[model samples]
Target: MNITVHRPGELSAVDRAAWTALQSRAHLHGSPGLANPFLSPEFTLAIGHERRGVRIAVAREDGEPAGFLPFQRSATGVGRAIGLGISDCQGLVHRPGFDWNARELLRACGLSLWEFDHLVSGQAPFEAHASATFASPVIDLDQGYDTYLRHLRERSPKFIKGTLAKERRLSRDHGAVRYVHDERDPAVLTTLMGWKSAQYRRTGRSDRFAHPWIVRLLRRLFHTRADSFAGVLSVLYAADVPIAAHFGLRSERIHTCWFPAYDPAFAKYSPGLIMHLGMAEGAAADGIAHIDLGRGQKVYKDSLKTRELMVSEGWVALRHPVAFGHRARRAPVRALRNTVQTRPELFEPADKLLKRMGRIRSRGGE
Candidate 1:
C-alpha cells in the first residue's frame, strides 16, 4: 500500500471521484455504520473550503485508490478528525479488504498524534485503539415510517400519543401546522443558527456557531447539493410562523442529524419532536433508510431511537513529545467527562452547574 497526502481541494477531479466511489462501495458492502454523510467527499471538501489545515490522506493498493482519510493538523503537530466537533461520525473511507496501521498512516500524513471522538464502530485499525466505546443512538427507517411508529408505540405509547397530541393542539390553536422537509430559505437557516447558539449557551456548552469558520461551513453546506452528500434543512411552522428547525447532511441512504433547535416560546408544544417526525417521514419518502442521531445520551434519543450504533472516543499517538503533550492536556478533561457520564449522581450536579453557568453567561455574567 502507498499513501499520499493532499490538501482537500488539491485532489484532482478524478481522485475525488475515486474517493467518492470508495465511500459508496464501503457503505454498500461494509457495515451500516459506514453510511455517514460526514464520510462523503463533498462534506470534507466543503469543510476544506471553509477551514485551513485540512488534509486528505489517499491510500492506494496496486496503483488504485483504495482509501481516504480526511483530517486537520494543529500547529502543535496534533491531528484530529476533520470537523471533529461538528461531524457526528468519523473514519477512513476504504474499499473492502483495505488495511493499514494507524501509526504508519499518521506518520505518512506527518503527524505524531491523531485524536477522534465518534469513531465509527468496526473501523478496522482504530477500533482497538479506542479507550472507551459508547452507543450512538439512531432512528432506523428501513421498515418505513408506519412500522417505526408501531415499534415506537410498543416502546413508548405515551410519548407518541403525547407528542402527537401536542402537534394537534398546536395546529388547532395556531392554525394549520406545516412541515417543510427541505427548506431552502437562507433566513430560516440564519434563524436556526441563532436558536442553536442560544441553546448551547443555555446548556453551558460552547457555542459552535460563535466560530466564524463553523458559521461559514454551515452556510456553504446549506447551499451545497450533490448526490453523494447534500445539506438538508427541515422546518416546522404553525400558520406560516416557524416554530422549529433542523439542519443536517444526507446521502440517499443516510441522514445524519446535526444542529436542531426550536423557538423557546413554542417549547410547550414540542415542536422539535414534531420537526424530527416530519424529517423521518420526509426522509423516508426521499429514499433515506437510516437517520443517525449521533453519539451521546439524551432522553429524546432514548425515546425515539429504534436502535443504537456503537462509536469510540479516544486518541492514538506515537511515542513523541507532541503526542504525549496532547494526551496530558486532554486527559484530565476526558477523565472528568467520562466520570460524569458513568455516574448519574455526579452528572445531575454537573448539569445543574452547567445550566447555571449558561444562565450567567447568557445574562453577560461570564
Candidate 2:
C-alpha cells in the first residue's frame, strides 16, 4: 500500500470519485456509519475552505485508491479529526479489509499526535489507542416513520403524548403550527445561530458561532447540494414565526443531528422536542434510515433513541517527545472529565456547578 497526502481541495476528479465510491462500498458492506455526511469529502472540502491545516491522506493499493483519512494538523504537529469539536462522526473512510498502521499514517502526514473524540466503530487500528468509549444514541427508521412512532409510543407513551399535546396547544394558543424540513432562508439560519450561541453561554459552554470560520463553514454548507451530502435546516413555527430550529448534515441514508435550539420564550411548549419529532418524520420520509444523535447523553436523546452506537475518544501518537508531552498535559484533565461524565452522581453536581458559573458569567457580561 502507498500513502499520499493532499489538501482537501487538491483532490483530482478521479480521486474524489474513488474516495466517494469507497465510502459507498463501506456503507453497503454493513458499516452504515460511513454514510454520515460528516465523513463525506464535501464536508472535508468545506472545512478546508474555511479553516487552515485541513488535509486528506489517500492510501492506494496496487495504484488504486483504497482509503481516505481527513484531518487537520496544528503547528505543533498535532492532528485532529476534520472540524474536530463540531464533527459528530470521525474515522477513515476505507474499503472493506483495508488497514494501515496508525503511527505510520500519522508520520506520513507529518503529524506527531492525532486526536479524535467521536471515532466511529470498526476502526480497529485506532481502537487500541482509545482511552474511552461512549454510546451515541440513534433513531432507527428503517421501517419508516409510523413504525418508529409506534416504538416510541410504546417506550415513552407519556412523553410523546405530552409533547404532541403541547404541540397542539401551542398551535391553538398561537396559530397553525407548521414544520419546514428544508428551510432555505439565510435569515432563519442566523436566528438559529443566535439562539444556539445564547444557549451555549447559558450553559457555560464555549459558543461555536463566535468563531468566524465555523460560522462561514455553516453558511457555506447551508448552500451545499450533493447526492451524498447536504446541510438540512429544519424549523418549527407557530403563527408563522420560528419557535424551534435545527441545523444538521445528512447523507442519503443517515442524518447526523448537530445544532438544535429553540426560543426560550416558548420553552413552556417544549418546542425543541416538537421540532425533533418533526425532524424524525421528515428524515424518514426522505428515505433516511437513521438519525445519529451524536455521542452525548441527554434526557431528550434517552427518550427518543431506539438504540446506541459506540464511538471512541483518544489520541494515536508516535513515540516521540511531542507526543509524550502532549499526553502528559492532557491526560489528567481528560481523566477527570471522563470520570464526571460516566458517573451520574458526579455528573449532576458538576452540571449544577457549571450552570451556576454560567449565571455568574452572564451577569458579569451584562
Candidate 3:
C-alpha cells in the first residue's frame, strides 16, 4: 500500500471518481446508515474552501485507490478529523477488508496525534485508542415516515399525540402552520442562525455561529446540490411567519440532523419537535432512509430514535513529546466531561450550572 496527501482542492477528477465509487460500495454492502454525506469528498472540499488546514490522505493498493482519510492539521504536528465538532460521523473511507494502522496512518500524514470526538463505529484500528464510547441515536426511515411514526407511537404514544395536539393549537393560535422541506429563502436561514446562537447561549454552550467561518460554511453548503450530497434547510411557519427551522446535510439515503432551532416565544408549542417531524416526513419522500441525530443523549432523541449507532471519543497518538504534551493539556477537561456525561447524578448538576451561566451571559448581553 502507498499513501499520499493532498489539499482537498487538489484532488484530481479520477481521485474524486474513485472516492465516490468506494462510498457507494460502502453504502451497498455496509450497514444501513453508513452512507453518511459528511464523509463525502464534496463535504471535505466545501470545508477546505472555508478552512485552509483541511487535507486528504489517499491510499493505494495494487495501483488502485484503496482508502481516503480527510483531516485538518495544525502547525504543531497535531491533527483532527475534518470538521470534528460539526461532523456527525468520522472514519477513513476505505474498502472493506482493507488492513490499516491508525498510528502509521498519522505518521504518514506528518502528525504526532489525531484527535476525534465523533469517530464512527466499526473503525477497528481506532477502537483501541478510544477512551469511551457513546450511543448516537438514529431514526431509520427506509420503510417511510408512516412506519417511523408508528414506531414512535409504540414507544411514546402520549408524546406523539401531545405533540400533534400542540401543533394544532399552534396553528389555530398563530396561523395555519405550513412546512417547507427545502426552503430557498436566505432570510429564513439568517433567522435560524440567530435562534441557534441564542439557544447555545441559553444552554451555556459556545455559540458556533459566532465564528464567521462557520457561518460562511453553512451559506456555501446551503446552495450546494448534488446526487450524493446536498444541504437541506427545512422550516415550519405559522401564519406565514417562520417559527422553527433546521439546516442539515443529506445524501441519497442519509440525512444528518445538524443545526436546529425554534423561536423561543413558541416554546410552549414545541416548535423544535414539530420541525423534526416535518423534516422526517419530507425527507422520506425525497428518498432519505435514515436521520442521524448525532452523538449526544437527550429526551427527544430517546423518544424519536429507532436505533442507536456507537461513536467513540479520544485521540490516537504516537509516543512523541508533542503528543504527550497535547494529551497532558487536554486530559483534565476531557476526563471531567466524560465523567459527567456518563453519570446521571453528576450530569444533572453540571447541566444546571451551564444553564445558570448561560442565563447570566444572556442577561449581560441584553
Best by lDDT: 2
Q: lDDT tens digits, residues 1-366, model 3? A: 999999977899999988887777676767444468888898899889888789999999999998899999999989989998888888788887887999899999999999988887888898789988899998888999999999889889999999999999998899899999999998889999999999999999999999999999999999999888899999999999999999999987889999999999999999989889998899899988889999888988887789998988899999999999999998899999888888999999999999999999999994
| Per-model TM-score versus the true fold | 0.97, 0.98, 0.97
**Model 2 Cα shift for residue 272 (angstroms):** 0.8
Candidate RMSDs in Å, in order, are 1.3, 1.1, 1.2
The lDDT for every candidate, in the order shown, is 0.89, 0.92, 0.90
What is the TM-score of candidate 1?
0.97
lDDT (Cα, 0-100) at 45 in candidate 3 = 90
lDDT per residue as tens, model 2, 246-278: 999998889988999999999999999999999
Question: Which 10 consecutive residues of model 2 have the lowest summed lDDT?
Answer: 19-28
Candidate order (lDDT):
2, 3, 1
Backbone clashes (count) for model 2: 0
